[model samples]
Target: MNKQPQGNIFHTPEMFRVFDQTKGHKSTLWAVVDNDNCPLALLLPVHVTLMNGLLRQLTTRAIAYGSILSVPGTAGQTALALLLQTYKREAKGTALFTELRNLSDLGQPQTLLNDNGFAYEGHLNYLINLNRPAEELLQSIGQRTRKKIRKGLRDGFVQMSEATTLAELEHWYEILQKTYSNAQVPLADRSLFMAAFNELYPKGMAKFLLAQVNGVTAACSIELPYKNVIYGWYGGSDRAYSDYLPNEMLIWHILEWGANNGYGIYDFGGAGKPDEEYGVRDFKAKFGGDLVNFGRNVYVHNPSLLKLSKRGYEVYRRFFIR
Candidate 1:
């Protein structure tokens, strides 16, 4: 929920201005208050959706990310207390996979979310503190992967940022489509990303990376810069880049930039689970990332409601996602 913008200082630049306008179908955000009810952090939800608000669409639950309820210094506790108060007082509804991503305070959020009746399917992420030398960091990769990194350098790949133009984002859209199509996973909404990129490009708190060779785009990634930490949010690469190790080099450049820019952590982001994404897990670990079970400690308010609705989701997943 948002009131008219009053130019609060605690607002995170990472949140897009479009989110400030509240144009999407269904979105949740954090709000801060002072002793006199002053507003603080009203951030974008970790999850994005278009729900009917009316229970007409209220038939399931979902996991969400990036749902941050922050209040300058002491209001974090106040914000959580407010969330519990509102959740306890609100009417019941249904949802499908309301995920809360980018929660740094995993313990507090899991407690608040569980108390509010949300279940954490899991938290997916690996964070690498970019506090070490680049060469020292590079040495940590698996032998074969390390060799691949060296080969990538030999193949004439170059790493650069802001080379990622509108054309590249569109190309990435195509690459991502191909990736999802090949993997049979759902593609994220394109307009949502377009809006996101348009809002956060260049000046604000966003950065894009491009791996190029002979002036051709090979691998690319995007990072969300906030509070001196850059999140390795999204990326894709052509098959050739994998052979050349441009992906590794792209990250190498990114990490270098982060270090110089005063950033402390390079969140390689989530890799699902080790069992499901062993390759990804191994790949990120090569960069000195550590696994963090991000969203496991939850407190559920209505266990019966969640249990009762599982069958609907079971059938829906089998029919649609499966």
Candidate 2:
């Protein structure tokens, strides 16, 4: 999979290991291989369940983080179709839906996916080029963002560092929990981060970072760095420190760090659907990256249950997430 140019970190063995070890996450690998056993197409879809018992059934959904990885041309398309058919047959009663979160243009496979019952939706993402001088990169940021970053650094109260210990990871997760809770969005189990720290961190595939204000951690971001790109995974900030702009400072620090460290691009993991009013997308836009509509495709295995699952999720957020 790594040999495929479009293959992403989420499709790699490291991520598969992390997901397999994480609570509420079950990853499955599917591939189409030739007679000689050479792989033609591959996919790693992680089945995510958010709650316990019955609620778990409602929340269960499979996400293919980087979509399908296939060798170039018609042969790859044929393999993908066969794999999709096999997965669909076996995936019944397992989840409400299966979504492919695409990272690149799937020219021919897009039609293949549609024919196979995967409906496409427009999604957006930001990709910032980092193959330039730090000064150039700084100047590329929005005027206001640049000013805030400069002022935040000038204050001398904000500091950034890579998280190393379990205590530090816990602290970072606390900030993320508060942020997600307040937003009423269900976050992945903490075990996911713990697993990433164990499997991906040691190999330099994952980076956990902390931003501090007056020695107290105020913001945190977890990134997956693979090949020449750094994929922003999860992040949050303590609103109490909003005045310090710790989030902005922390992001700029990563951009600058990436520029100097030889990385080629910084991927804002995802913006939201193009038609939606997502504040996160607006915030990422100010970072001066090229917006790309990689979009996503989803196949609903249980349409009736999907509707119920949506309502159930709201209830779950109210009673369980906090």
Candidate 3:
């Protein structure tokens, strides 16, 4: 699957192991192979069950990051169609919905996806090219963002470094937990990140970076690096240090590190739906990356249940999130 152009970290064996070992996450793989047993197409979706008790069933959903990985042309499309059919049959009633997050252009296979019951939705993402000179990359940044980064560095208010120990990773995770808790959003358990650190960090498939202010961790980000692309997976900051622009510095540090290390692209994970008003999207846009609408394909097994689940989530957020 790594040989395929669209293959991403989420579709790899390493990530599958991360999800499988993580609490509340169930990883599944479906593939189409040739007579000689060569893989023609592959799909790896992880069912994430959040919250507890009855809410877990409602919030459980599958996410296929980077969508279907397949060979080019008609044969590949045929294989993908077959794989989708088999996967849909097995996935029915397993979750509220299965979302295929497309990282690259699916091209003609999108029709096959629609035919297989997945409906398309418009989504957006930012991609910063890292295969350029460090100066060129810096010059491309939006003027305002560049100023904030410069001011933070010039004043020595924030320091950026990669987390090198388990404790450091945990510290970073604490910031992420607080950020999600404040936003009333569901975050995966710490076991997921611990697994990634244990399994992927040593292999250079993962990186944990920290931004510190006055020797205290103020912001953090976890990046999944596969092939030539560094995917920005999770990140958050201590809002108390917002004046120091820790988030901006953290992102700049990642970009600089990637550009200096021969990485080709930094995928800004996601930018929310195009039709929605997302503050994070506006924040990400200031970093000077090309915005792309790769979109997403969703197959909801039970629409009425999904609606109920949405309402249940609102209650969960209002009462149980803290």
Work out the TM-score per prediction. Answer: 0.73, 0.97, 0.97
Name the TM-score of candidate 1: 0.73
Residue-level lDDT for 109 in candidate 1: 47
RMSD of 3: 1.3
User: Candidate 3's residue-wise lDDT over 1-322, tens digit each?
Assistant: 6577787888888889999999999999889999988888888889888865867778899988768888898878889989998888887888999999999888988888999889999999999999999879988999988977877778987987888898888888899999999888888899999999988999999989899999998999999888999999999989998988889988998899899999999999999999899999999999899999989999998899899988988887899898
Among all windows of 10 consecutive residues in model 2, the one with the lowest summed lDDT is 313-322
Model 2: colliding residue pairs: none
Once fitted onto the true fold, the runs of candidate 3 whose alpha carbons sit more than 4 angstroms away are: 51-56
Mark the 10 consecutive residues where model 1 has the least summed lDDT. Answer: 1-10
- Is candidate 1 or 2 superior in lDDT? 2
Please provide, for model 2 over 1-322, each residue's C-alpha lDDT reduced to its tens digit, 9 standing for 90 to 100: 6578898898888899899998889999999998999888887889998776867778899999989888888889889999999999998998899999999888888999999999999999999999999989999999999988888878888999988999988988999998999888888889999999999999999889899999998999998889999999999999999989888988998899899999999999999999989999999999999999989999999999999989977777788776
Ranking by lDDT: 2, 3, 1
Assess the local accuracy of residue 265 in candidate 1 as a C-alpha lDDT between 0 and 100: 78
Which candidate leads the pack in lDDT?
A: 2
Ten-residue region with minimum lDDT total, candidate 3: 50-59
lDDT of each: 0.57, 0.91, 0.89
Listed per model in order, the count of residue pairs whose N, CA or C atoms clash below 3 Å is 24, 0, 0
lDDT of 1 by residue, 111-200 (tens): 656666655666567777777676665676567766777676666557565634677677666765665555545455666457557766
